[model samples]
Structures are given as structure tokens and as C-alpha cells.
Target chain A: MAVLFGGVACLALAGGVGVIASRRPVHSVLALLLVLGSLAVDYLLLDAQFIAVLQLIIYAGAIVVLFVFVIMLLHARSGEVARVPAVLPPAAAIPVCAVFGLMLLVVLTGAAIAPAAVGPAFGTVQEVGRALFSRFLLPFEAASIVLLIGMIGAVVLGKRLPPSPPDAGRPAEGPGEGRSKRRVELR
Target chain B: MSTADLVLVGPELVLTIAAVVVLLQDAWATGGVLEPQTPRPAAVWGSLAAVGLALVWDVGGRRWGPAFGGMYVRDQFTMIADLAALAAAGLGILLSSAYLPRVRLPAGEYHALLLLATVGAMVMAASGSLITLFLGLEILSFSLYVLAAIARRSRRSLEAGLKYLLLGAFATAFFAYGIALIFGATGSIDLREIGAARPSRLLGAGIALLTVGLAFEGALVPFHAWAPDVYEGAPLPVTAFMSVVAKVGAFAGLLRVFPLALAHLAGVWGPMLAAIAVVTMILGNLAALFQTNLKRLLAYSGIAHAGYLMIGVAAGGPAGTWSVLFYLLVYVAMNLGAFGVLLLLARQGMEADRVEDLAGLSGRAPWAAAALVLFLVSLAGLPLTAGFIAKLYLFRAALGAHQPVPALVGVLTSVVSVYYYLRVASAALSGGAPQAVAVLRNRLVGAALVLATAGVLWLGLFPAGFTAAVQQAARQAAAAVR
Candidate 1:
């Protein structure tokens, strides 16, 4: 059991690193899928069957497919230059990251984790549903609004503008500008 | 949930429903296509009516207690915050009505997002549990992010949106991690439960991280790098609305977490917040002095005002709570009114945002120039305006809580702030040849200006009635934790 856990965890870690380190957008999505799949396996190993299935179905299957769709839709080139400027230089970022990691290490090492006993229904779909509908109802309902706002924002920001009039002078710089440029490059 | 639960969140429901209706109405009216130049009055009036109705629910409903398994609360604190947020939303829409069509922004989306953002602030103010608070904060931040970038035609607006989103996401991560740590330490995410649990180093670190997140939202110093740029780059009405709404939401969360929930640990966080307050005031004011852009200047002034409000938060008592509430109400008026005057100067596809834009304003538009003077003076905390009374209450609260140093710094900073605030005022009152900045003659903006001006004067001159009411409410709120 311990070896199985260790192997899956290592796979997940490697997949996470690949997601960030990959040069190609398609490769990054594939790496993300690996991470999600490994996480699901780890959940299954822990006897969280329902959660493991949900993880595979929602994140690995649906969400990753969506990422691929977006990447394809944008025609993201493999060698596209990073347009957004880096906030911190690597010289500064390295030490900051090292310090943060050290702090996390210290905090985690010092803290004691005492796992609480759970009921027989723990990790069951029914139990999770009950909690969602009862004690956590407010946040659950509020999350819908969050999702709704996300949809609205995606439409408002991502929608292509109608063809500009000849006399419109300079065209308005919408989010679609970069996408159209990329499409032209592809063609 | 029960009918009572729904009633408790009546204002939020009204606004949410209104947002959906406005969005649908927009889709129906525009047929999902950008059209000829007429501005949709329906969106503006619908949003105004929604805000007005929400205000009625907030005041008239008056069902004060916890709901949603103690996740949400409707009390005097929430009421005061709702009033401030609703006021900002109403005035923000009024200010945006004329500018929308001129810029060809979809009025429906703008008004819907604005209404939703207002609901987010109201939720944050009414949150009883940490989960509710975080959710409310996300809702508020998300809507504002979109609204900030709604003017996609402008590269500056898009840049502002991206910057705001990245920094804001970082802040939210800090906040969420802090909540996790607090829950781990106390084994509960409820504010009252956390208060009852004994404090530990974990809890302390969590609280500090939580303060960082709230301070970022409030635009307090050190966490305020994005405020000036975002304020300058976002559309004028967005800047105006967000300036007040963000502060209202942040300060409300601060009041809940520090004073009401964690009052017993005041010794731990009080001095920490006081130090932040002092620096925020000094840095915010000093920074404002160098800014030539009116939007950026107001942004810095906002940071300084956050410091003043923090003094009240650090005080941690009934006096502190009510003073913060009163100051927020006054801030909505003064800040929005100042932005409203600037909104009038917005012409076809460009905002008259520079300090020079207000030059010769007295010659061109006397009422606007005069109104700008009133708002700036109020912001400078001069007597006969609500800003003075607000500062007075905050300083007294600090002194009453035995924090004389912050009070002294507050006074000194207000003096320095006057220099900058009056510079803008004087430019409008008496400057060289007035630039041909076309001031949009819209009655909606004029009515908003009148309403905000009345609120400022009423709160300043005859503050007795509101003061008494807030004091009573503050006492009740403070008693709830005990």
C-alpha cells in the first residue's frame, strides 16, 4: 500500500512539474491530465472511490478536454513569445522562492496533525451531498453566482467585435486581437 | 433554508434577480449585436430601481439575526454597509448612464456587473462565517475585474484588468491559506467559533496573512502598488464605483474579523494594525502629492482614507465600529461625488483624467467646478463637511482606546492631504485658460451630484440623528460577539 502511494505521488509531482515546464501548450494540457489522473488513482488507493471517480470524470476528462479545445481554438503556436512581462527577475525570485519553501518546511514540520475519526458514511456520495445541501449550502449556492459571473466575463471579454466601419479610424483593441493575429500567422 | 433565511438575504436576492433581468433585457434589446448609438435607458433605470428596491429591503425588512446555519448575518453592521454599498452602486450607475453610449459600452453588461458587484459587497459585509466571507470577497473581486476591463477598446483598461486580476488572485490565495490555517488551529471556520478557541502561533500567522489580504483590498500602503495604475487605467465610472465599494467591503470584513470576532486577542493585532495605519496614512498622502492625474491622486487619497478607517478598526470597541461605519457612509458620498465631477468631463471615447483637464473649469462649467470644490474640501476633512466629522469620530475612537500616536499621525497626515486636495480644487476654481474639455450635460449625473452633496452636508451639519442611530447599532453588534 505504501509503495503504491509513493509511486502515484511521484507521478503526480512529475506531471505537475511537466505542466509548468513544457514548451508546447498541448503538452502542458497532457501533463495536467497526467497529474489529475494520478491524483485520482491516489484517491482510489485511499478508498475514496466516489471522489476518485468524480476527479477522473470532472477534471481529467471534461476540464482537460476543454483546455485542449481552447488551445486549438486560439491556434496557440508552440514558439509564441511570452508577451506579459515577468514580474520578478529570476535572481530575486529564486531567493524569494527558497525562503518561502523553507518557511513552509518549518511550519509543516512543527505542526502536529491529529486526524479525526470519521463515521461509516465518510467519503460516500450521499454524505458529501448531504453536507453540500445542508451545512455548506450558502457557499454552494454562492459558487453558482461565481460560475455565472465567470461565464458572463468570458463572453464580455472574449467575444469578437463586429467588423469595424471604414471610417472608424483605429479599431478598438479587444481581447480577440491576439487571437486573430495568431490565426493569421497560422494561415 | 427557511423563509426567514431568504428574508435575511433579501437585498442580495433582489439585486441578483435584477442583474439577471437586466442581462436578459439587454440581450433582447440589442439582439446580442452591437447597434446604433442610442444608450439604453432601460438598463440604467432598471439598475437604479433594483438598487433602490434593495435599499428598501435592507432598511424596511430589518430582520436582524444569523441565517444559513450561522453563515450569514443581517444586523446593524450589515445594514450600514449595505446602505453605503447601495449608495455607491446607485450613484455609480447614474454616473455611468451618459458615458456608456458615448463610449459604446453595452449598458446592460455594465449595469449587470455593477449590480452583481454591489451584491458581493453586501454579502461580504453580512458574512458570518469565514467561508461566506471568502465567497463574498471572490464574488466582489470577480465582477469588478470584468467591469474594470469592460471598455475593451482601451488597451489601458485591459492592462488594468489583467494587473488587478493577477495581484488580486495572489491576495486571495493568501487569504484562503490563512483561512485554512485558522480552521486548522481552531477546528472551525465560523468567526464566533474561532473567537472562542484559544489563540496559538498558527492562529496568529493566519490572522496576519488575513490582514494582508484585507489590506490589499482596502488599498492600504505596502499592499497598494496596483491601486494607482488600475484607478488611472480603468474606465472613470468603474474607478469611481470600485473606489468606494472595495473599501466598504474590505473595512466591513476587517470590522468583523478584528473587532467583533477576535476582540479578545486585540493585544496581538492592535499595535500591528496601528503601525500599518500610520504608514498607510503617511505614504498614501505623500504619494498623492506627486500625482498629476486626478484618478491616481484620488486613488492615493483613498489609501490615506483607508489608514484613517484602520485607526477605528485597531481601536476595537463600539466607538471604533460605529465610527468606521459612519466614516464609510461619508466616504461613499465624498469619493463618488469627486469621481462624478470627473465623469462629466468624459467625451467621445476619451476621459479628461488629468489634473490639467480641470483647469479653467470655473469658467466653462461653474456648477461642476463648484461641486468639485465641495467634494475635494470634504475629502480634505474641512469643517462643514462630512469628512471632518468622520475623521473626528475616528480620531476620538483612537484616543478613547488609548492610541494617541495613530490619532496624532492621522491629524498630521490630514494636514498634508489638504495641500494636494486643494491643489485640484484651486485648479478648477482659478487656473489659466480653461482647456476645451467638453463637459457632458447629462441630468442623471447632475442629480447624482446633488444627492451626494446633500448627503455630505446632512451628515456633517446635522449628524446627531445618524450618529445616535449608528451608536446604538454599534453597541448591538459589539454585544453579539460577547
Candidate 2:
């Protein structure tokens, strides 16, 4: 058990560092996928099987796909100037180190004195399902509402207009009115 | 969820279904491979019916207690807050009924988004858990984002939408991080459990961040960079809806969580919030004093009002919470009417957003001019109006809670706000060209304006009965909090 924990923890740490150390955006994103994938494995180790599955499908699958697509859409290229910095400047590191130090202090002081061992049912699918269906139902439904609103918002905001007979709209153009007319970028 | 639990969230469920129906029906009717028809009468009526039903269910005499394992609850506080939110939506719909076409926006999507936003606000108001509160806030914020940008050809509207979305998300991050900290400290997501938590760095940090998030929504100053621009840019009805409903939703959650869950830690936090209230009131009023744009002025005023409401929270007791409720209700009527009157200017192909546009409104549209003055007076907290009563109660509550400095700040800021409120009134009533922009005549808008005015005057003239109802609800709020 100790060996397994040490190996996975080291792998996750390496992946986190690699995510920032990589010169290429693509490499950075790939390293992020690694971190997420290993994080899912950690959830699995902790017996949060449902969350582990969600992590795999949602974060590793959907979110990373979105990231890759965005990179592709932006036509990302790895060149000397285009490359992301592998390390932060001293100025940036000050705040970053400060935050890290604070978190360490908090974790040290507020650490759980003892964590009670729970049955295997604690994070199992059936147990989670029971709790969600009964006690957590309102929030469950609220989450769905949030998702539905997200879907509607995305479609409404993303819809494009056909800028036909553009001359006819000329008379209505006031100061800064050029933006009111929609222009498709990719097309 | 059991049927019994379902009963508690009945209004939210009805609104959810109604919103979806409105969205689908509007899309089917208006957006297809054919020439579009005006969004059907049935769609708007259906949505209105849903809102009415929600209002009824909210204020209805049903047993109130925790539901969904205490994550969501129906209580007097939630009910009163929901009632105010629903009233704002109702007025918003009425205003949109007339204003949307003039602005060249679709009604179907607008009304649907508005209903969905109301549902979000209601959820936020009623949530017993932080997770629920966060979800509700997201729901509200997203719908408003879409609603703000619905003016497809309006750059200002789109800008407003983008600004609101970016700033709102930032605030949400603060809120989520705070919730995580609180959960880490207390090992629970429930606000009631959070109230019982021992003081610690984790809890203090959590409460501070949580206050930041709520302050953003409430438009308390220093966190209020988004309000002026967003208010200036969005469609007037959307502005009115956002101004009132967002505050009510956020304040309801603040009232619930702070006065209960974090009441234990108020010794450290209360003074901090009171200072915020002082700054918010002073800065908000001072900003409003110079604003020429009517909507922007109202936005600053909205921030100032947030200061008053935070006084209720800082006051940290039953009196404070109930005063917040009373203030929110009064705020809805006056603020909604003020924005609704601005919709009258849309008939001229001009957004009546400017103080200059309101000049000579008295001669041009007597009733609108009168209504605007009434709302402004109420907003200024003048005697014999709802605003005065609301402020009086709020200050009394503030002193009762031993937050004397904030109470004093509240009184002084009311005096400062009077100048700007009267400025708007004078701009409207004073001399200029009497050439009237033909006002759009919609039965619903006219009806809503009348209702707002009646609510304002009735509550002012006859405070006895309303005060009694507020007292009853305050008792319930106390019981639920305890």
C-alpha cells in the first residue's frame, strides 16, 4: 500500500510540474490530462468510485477534448517567442510562494486528528445513489437546472447572423454601430 | 425525491417546466426554415401563469420545514423573499411585453430566460446548503447573462452581458472557494451546521470570501465596478429585473447564512461588514450624485440600497433579518416602477436612459412623470412612502442589533441620496421642450406600473397591516434561524 501510494503521488507531482514546464501548449494540455487521469485514480483508491468515473468522463474526456479543440481552433504553434515560460519570474513567484506557504500552515494546523474508517459502502455507487436520491435531491435537481441553463445560454449567445445586403444597414449605423452587425470569423 | 419533499420545491419545479416550455414553444414558433411569426400570446400568458402560480405557492399556507435532507427549505424568510423576486419577474415580463418589440428582441426567449432567472433567484433564496446557494446563483447569473445580450443588434447590450458574465464568474469563484474553506472547517455544507462551527482561521477566511461573493451580487461598493456599465448597457427591463431580483436573492442567502450559520463568528465579522456598509452607502450615493444616465444613476442608487440591506445583516438578529425582507419588498416596487417608466421613452426610438431625455417629461407624459417622481421620492426615503418606512425599520433594526455606527451611516446616506433622487425628479419635471415621444401603450405595462404605485402608497399610508404581516414572518424567520 505504501509503495502504491508513493508511486502514484510521485507520478501526479511530476505531471503537475510537467504541465507548466512544457514549452508547447499542446504538451502542457497533455500533461494536464495526465494529472487529471491520475487524480481519478487517487479517487478510486479512496473508494470514491462514482467520483472517479465522473473524473474520467467529465474532466479527462470532455474538458480535455474542449481544450484540444480550442488549441486547434487557435492554430497554436510552438515557436521560440510563442513558447510559454517554463518558470515564473521572482516577482510572480513571491505571491505564488506566499500562497503555498499559507496553505501549508493551514493544512498543518487544521489537519484532522483522526479520520474514522468507514465501510466500503461509504463511496460506493449504491450508497451515493441512495443519498443523492433522498437527502441530496434538491441540489441534484438544481445542478440539472444549472446545466440546462448552460446549454441554453451557449446556444443563444453563439448563434450567428447572415450579414446579407450589408449596404441596407448603412443608414442605421450610428457612432460605434459597426459592431452591431455580426461578422463570422472562420467563414 | 419523495412526493412530500417535492411539495416543498413545487414552485421551483413549476417554474422550471414553464421556462422550458416557453423556450421550446418560442423556438418552434419563431425560429425555423420559414418566415418568423411574432412569439405567440399563449407563450407569454403561459409563462405569466407559471409565475403567478409560483407566487401563490410561495406565499401559500403550507407547512414549512426542511426538505431534500435540509439542503432546501420552505420557510417564512424564503417565502417572503420569493414573493418579492416573483413580483419583480412579473413586472419585468409586463415591461418586456411592450419594450421587447421596440428594442427588436424576441419575446419567447426573453420571457423564458426571465422565468428561469426567477427560478434561480427563488432557489438561492430558499437554499439551506452552500452548494444549493452556489448552484442557484449560477442559474440566476447565467440566465441574466443571456437576457442582457438578447438585444442581438445592440453592442451596448452585448458588452453589458460580457461584463456581467466575467465579473459574476470571478465572484462565484470566490464564493466556491469560501464554501470549500467552510466545509473544510466544519465538515458540513449546511449553513445551520456552519453556524455551530468553532472559530478558526479556516472559518474566518471562508466567511470573508463568502461576504465578498455576496457583496458582488448585492453591488456593494469596491465590488461594484460592474453595476454602472451593465445597468447603462442592458435593456431597461432587464436592468430593472437584475437590479431588484439579484439583490433579493443574494441578500436572502446572506440573511439566512450570516445571521444563523456565521452568527457565532459575528463578533469578528460583524464589524467588518458594518464598515463595508458604511463605505458602500457613502460611495454609492456620491457616485449617483453626478450620473446623467438614468439607469446608471439607478445602478449607483442600487449599491447604496445594498449598503442599507447589509446593515440588516450586520445588525445580526431577528429584527435585522425582517427589516431586510421589508426593505427588499419595498425596493422591488419602487425600483421596478422607476425602470418601467423609462421604458415609456422607448416609443421614441430612443432609450430613455439619459437625464436629458427625461426633461419636460411632466408636460409630455404627466402620469409617467408623476410615477417617476413617486418612485424617486420613495427611493430617497421621504416621509409617507414605502422607502421611508423600509429605511426607518432598517435603521431601527441596525440600532437594535447594536450596530449604531452603521445605523448612523445609513441615516446620513439617505440624506445624501435624496439629492440625486430629487435631481432625477427635477430633470423630469423642470422646463424643456414639451414635445412628447408617443409612449407605447401596453395593458400589462400600464397594469404593472399601477400595481407598483399602489403597493408603494398603500404600504406607506397603511403600515399597520403590512407591519403585522412582517412581524409574523419575522417570528417564523427567528424560529427557522434558531
Candidate 3:
């Protein structure tokens, strides 16, 4: 069990390092996918099977795909220089990882953890449903409102601008000058 | 879900419904918000009416509880903060109606989105559960992101929106991670339970990260890079709305959580917050000294005020908490009023943003020039305006709570800020050549300034009644502590 945990942890760390270090946005997105996937695996190992599956389905599948779609939509030029070096020397990474591992050890061991706090029924859909509908009902409903507002705002921003005189659009192409001009025109 | 929950959430529910009504009405209205034939006043009226309705539910009142299984609460602080948030939203709508057409933004959608943001802020003011707080914060954030760019034709507007979206999402992620860690530590999301939980290193780290997220929303230094540009680039009314509403919402939530439940761990977070307050004040004021544009100057001033408000948060008690609320009332009025005066000065051909535009203001428009001076003096925290009394009470609270250094910094920074604020005021005094064209004076905006000016003097000159009322509210909010 310990060996499997160590392997998964190493993979997760490596995936994280790839995310920031990658030169391409697409590669960074893929790195994010890897890290998220490894995190799901970690969740499964901890027996929060529902969270593990949800994390994979929601974050790895849906969110990452959405990110890819947005990147494509923007048509941003590719292959920008990496802001930081692609990778650090093993000497540096090793000590940083050691410090991180030490912090984890302290958090995991210094705090008391209850052994077998729940049974196999834990993390089931029905259990989550019960909790959501009962104790967490207000927040659950509030989340819906947040999502609804986000949808409306997205539409407001994304909708096609109403057709105006062709000459009106040309001068407004550059933002800084357009801003001052529009500021006055909005009168 | 339950009647009690309904009662606790009644104000936010009304605001949300009003938002939807405004949006639907916008779609149904003829010609849309900008066309010459379209009547765009419904959304603005509806938004204001909604604020009035919400205030009717709890105006000058107080209630307390762990609503919805400890997910929400109502108290004096919530009442004070919610009223302030609603007032800011109402004023924004009033100020935007005439300005929107001048800028060619669709009136209906802009008002609807502004209402939605208000709902979010109201939620933030009352949230007792961490989940609810996150949702509330996001609702406010998403709406503002769109509103910042509502003037879609402007490159700067779009850039401001995009920058806000990116930086805001980054801040939200930090906040979410902090929530996750906090959940891990307490094994529960109930704020009271989390407070009762032990002070683990994990919880401490979680709180520090959470403060960073909230700090960004409040525009504290280091997290405030977005303010100057975004404020200058976005529409003046939108900038005014954001500066007032966002600070009210974010600081209200910060006060609710940190001072009430997390006070036990003050040893962990207090000093860190105090350090943040000092740096934020110094940087914000010093930077304001160099600004050439009035919008950018006010943005920096907003940042400095955030720092002063934080002094109360660092103090962490009933006196400190209520003092912050009083100061927010003062801030909402003065900040928006300053922008209101600017909005009136806007011309069909010029934005009136440059410092030189105000140079001959006294000669060009005496009333506006006077109003501008009133707002600037108040902003400078001089006596005879609410800003002075606000500073007085705020720093005193900080001192009463034993945070002497931050309070002292607040005093010094106000002194530094006076130099720049006065420079703007002097433009009105210099009375340069008279304007070629008459200044545009939208009645609604003019009324907003007059009202704000009245509020500033009333609060400063005769603060006794309002102070007592807020003190009563603060005393009730303290019940959450035990």
C-alpha cells in the first residue's frame, strides 16, 4: 500500500511541475489533466470513491475539454517562451519535494485522524443526496443561483453586438483610444 | 427549504427576482436599451424599487440565528452591511441611466447585471456557511466581469473585463483551495463548528490563503494591481459601482467570519492581517500621489480606504466591526459621489477624466465644482464630512483593540492622501478659462451627488443617532461569538 501511494504521489508531483513548466498552452492543459487524474486516483486510494469518480468526470473530462475549446476559440499564437525554466535540476527539486513531503507528514501525523470513521455506505450517491437535501440545503440552492447568474452574464458578454454603422466599428478596434472615445459617446 | 430559511433569505430572494424581472423586461421592451425609440428606464427603476423593497424587510432592525442548519445568519452587522450594499446598488443604477446612453450601452442588461451583483453582495453580507459565502462571492464576481465590459466597442473595456475575469478566477481558486483545506481540518463546513475545531497548522494555512483571496477582492496592496487600470478603463459608473459594492461585500464577509468565529485563533491571523493593512495603506496613498487622471486617483484612494477598513477587521470585536460598517456607509457615499460629479462633467466629445478638465471647473460650473470640492474634502477625511468621523471612529477602534501601529499608519496615510486630493480640489479653485460648452447635468446623477453630500455632512456633523443604531447592531452581532 505504501509503495503504491509513493508512486502515485510522485506522478502527481511530476504532473504539477509539468503544468507550469510547459511551453505550449495545450501541453499545460494536458499536464493539468494528468495532475487531476492522479489526484482522483489518490482519492480512490483513500476510499472516497465517489469523489474520485466525480473529480475525474467533472474536472478531468468536462473542465479540461472546455478549456481546450476556449483555447481553440481564442486562436492564440502558439509556442510562447516558458516564463520559468522547463525543469529544475534534480538537486533543487529533490529538496523542495522533501520539504513538501515533510509538511504533509506533519499535517497527516500531527493531527489526530479517526480510524474507520465510516463504513462502506460512505461516499455513496444517496448519502450525499441526503446530506445535500438536509443539512446543506441552503448552500445547494445558493449554488444554483450562482450558476444561473454566471450563465446570464456569459450570454450578455458573448452575444453578438447589435449592428451599427460600419465606420463606428473601425476606430474602436484599438482598446485604449476606443475607451476614451466610447467614454464620451456613451453620453 | 424551510420557513425559517425563507425568512432569513427573504431580502436576497427579492433582489434576485427583481434581477430576473429586469432581464425579462429588457428582452420584452421595444427597441432595446440604446435605440432612440427604446425606453430604458424600467430596469433602472425596477432595480431601485427592489433595493427599496429589500430595505423595507429589515430597515433599522436586527435578527440573529444559525439559519438553515448553520449555513446563514441575520444580525445587526448583516442589516447594516446589507443596507449599505443595497444603497450602493441603487445609487449605481440611478447614476447609470443617463450615462449608459451617453456611452451607448444597452440599458436593460446593464441594470439587470448590476442587480444580480447586488444580490450576490447581499448574500455575502449575511452568509454564515462557507459554501454560501463562496457562491455569493462568485455571483458578485461573475456579474461585475460582464459589467466591466458592457461597453463592448471599447478595447479598454473588453481588456478590463478579460483582466478582471482572469485575476478574479485566480483569486477564487485560492479561496476554494482554502475552503478545501479548512473542510479537511474540521471535517465540517459549518462556520461555528470550524471555529470550535482545534487550531491546527493546516487550519492556520487555510485561513492565511483565504485572507489572500478576500484581500484581492478588497484590492489590498500586492493584490491591487488590477484596480488602477481596470478602474480607469471601465466606464466611470461601473468603476464606482465596483469600488463601493465589492468592498462592502468582501469586507462584510471578512468581518463576519474572522472576528466572530475565528477570533480564538487571533494569534494566528491578527498580526498577518495588521501587516497587510499597513502595507496596503502606504502603497495605496503613495501611488495616488502621482496619478494624472481623476479615475485612477480615486481608484488608489479606494485602495487606501480598504486598508483603513482592514484596521477594524484586525481589531476583531463588536466595536471594531461596527466601526467598519459606519466607515463603509461613509465610503459608499463619498466614493460614489465623487464619481457622480465626474459623470456629470462628461461631455459628448470629451470624457472629462484628465486633471486639467477640472482646472477651470469653478468658472465653468460652480455647483459641480463645489460638489467636487465637498467630496474631495470628505475623501481627504477632513472635519465636517462623514469621512473624518469615519476615520476617527475607525482608528480609535483599532487603538482600543490594541493595534496601535496600523492605526498610526492609517493617520499618516490620510495625511499623505490629502496632498493629492487637494491638488484635484485646487483645480476647481484655480478657476481657469470658462468652458466652451455647458457641462452635462443629468438630474438623476445630480440628485445622487446632492444626496451623497447631504449624507456626508449628516454623518459627520450629527453622528450620534446613527452611531447608536450601529452600536446596537454590533452588540447583537457579538452574540455569534459565544
lDDT of 3 at A74: 62
Q: Which candidate is the best by TM-score?
A: 1
> Model 3's DockQ?
0.35
In candidate 3, what are the lDDT values of residues B40-142, reduced to their tens digit?
Answer: 7777788888888888875733445667877788877788888889889878987877777666676767887888888888888888778888888988888
Clashing pairs in 1: none
Instruction: Give the candidate order by descending DockQ.
Output: 3, 2, 1
Candidate 2 lDDT, A37-119, residue by residue in tens: 88888887888898899899999999999998888867645323356788899886896578557755875787463454668
Q: Write the per-residue lDDT of candidate 2 for residues B1-482, one digit (tens) a residue.
A: 57887788989888889988887887777762111224357666888899999888878746688888889878877888888989998888887776665444666667788998999889988888998898888888889888877665567777888999999997899889899888877788898877776777777667777887888988997799999888877877888899999998889888878875666666787888889899999999999998877888999999999999989888877788788888898999999999888877742344757777788888877998899999999999999999999999989988887889998888888998999899889988997843544555678888889999998998778877767776677678667656
For model 3, the superposed segments whose C-alpha errors exceed 4 Å read A72-116, A162-187, B30-39, B60-63, B347-350, B433-438
Q: Against the true structure, what is model 2's DockQ?
A: 0.32
For model 1, how does the per-residue alpha-carbon lDDT over B419-455 read when each residue is reduced to its tens digit?
9999999888887644456777899999999999999
lDDT of each: 0.87, 0.81, 0.80
- TM-score, cand. 2 vs. native: 0.90
What DockQ does each listed candidate score? Answer: 0.29, 0.32, 0.35
Better of 1 and 3 by TM-score: 1
Clashing residue pairs in candidate 3 (N, C-alpha, C atoms within 3 angstroms): A175-B155, A175-B156, A185-B102, A186-B102, A186-B103, A187-B102, A187-B103
Question: Using lDDT as the measure, what is the rank order of every candidate, best first?
Answer: 1, 2, 3
C-alpha RMSD of candidate 3: 4.1
